[model samples]
Target: MRLAPGRAILTLDLALKLALVVLLLLAVVFPDWEQFEGKAIGTRILTYPLSGLLVPAGWWLFFRGRPYPFAADVVVILPFVIDTAGNAANLYNSIWWWDDANHFVNWGLLTAAFLLVVRPLRLSWWNLLTLGIGFGAATAIAWEVLEYFAFIRNSPELETAYTDTLGDLVLGLCGSTAASGLMAVGYQHRELPARS
Candidate 1:
């Protein structure tokens, strides 16, 4: 049968969260798992649980008594799921385009989640676009810095790291700009909440 849209989204969010949990457990329990090694395992151990915490954190911070933001939660959780799964499957190395796609799509997902969470604020189009893109760009830069310090500094990947970092940043900006622009346009006609 079919599920309602919110229910379906909730289901998907739960499933993704479950997958992350399983990945986290594997990382902790079997740090030598064939699918991940060295820094990869450490990354998973650090990232997975933190990724899972975002939804509840957002709820506690922003959506306390309101309806659960399942769709927003999915948007927030999906990129981490995709990244972790890709690593587990070794797709980032095997599929030449996977990393590129992740850079673009994950940034888009993050920006979209930010917009969704803030929708009730009824900000103007310009404000939404600015904040969304700013958040995305800042995150993209932070992620690159993390990579540099975490693993890329000493790895063979450092040889092409400059170019790769530039491209990833550009892709992330494009993705976020696109998502923010679209969201701004869509919300342009809605009246902003009146200031007191």
Candidate 2:
């Protein structure tokens, strides 16, 4: 029997994660000494995941007729959207990549992810705060690792690698913090206890 779109998405998402593990091997390219600057790291990190997600996401968007689980919707959508756009900007680094704009863009996205996750997780105020910070930091580190070693690994002139990685972490934190704050405030008025 044919799988439903939702099921197909789940399968595809998992497959993408696995595929990422494989493509990570390509990270050890011959180094370029220059141009490995900060925020540029964010650009690199965003590339594969965005591309990995886009095809399946696009397919699902067309095939699925029913509404998604709320948390699932946010989890799936925002990352794909922001990452795709951000990485696209990276393609034209000589043209489209803007640092300040990228920071705010990522911050906005991470915040959205954090808030969305909180509602679904039904995190308490304290947990929400912890998760936001924790998630932000974790993703930032992972993204940096990917940037420094993976796609841009061959660059010898990585002046901004560390700086950009730092910026991405900061922006991610801002996003996560914003999300947790929204969740905490929203929970105060909400009667539903989203306990798992």
Q: 15-50 in candidate 1: lDDT tens per residue?
A: 999997776676677667665663556866676668
Estimate the TM-score of every prediction.
0.87, 0.54
Best by TM-score: 1
After superposition, the stretches of candidate 1 with alpha carbons farther than 4 Å from their true spots are 24-35, 189-196
Local lDDT at 194 for model 1: 57
TM-score of 1: 0.87
Question: For every candidate structure, what is the RMSD over all alpha carbons to the true structure, in angstroms?
Answer: 3.8, 9.3
lDDT of each: 0.84, 0.54
| Residue 114 in model 1: lDDT | 87
Model 2 per-residue lDDT tens digits across residues 1-196: 9888778767765754654534332332412322333335344445646644543464466534534443344454445444434433353255444554555455555655545533544667667666666776676677667657764556653765677677767776776667666666667657566789
lDDT of 2 at 38: 33
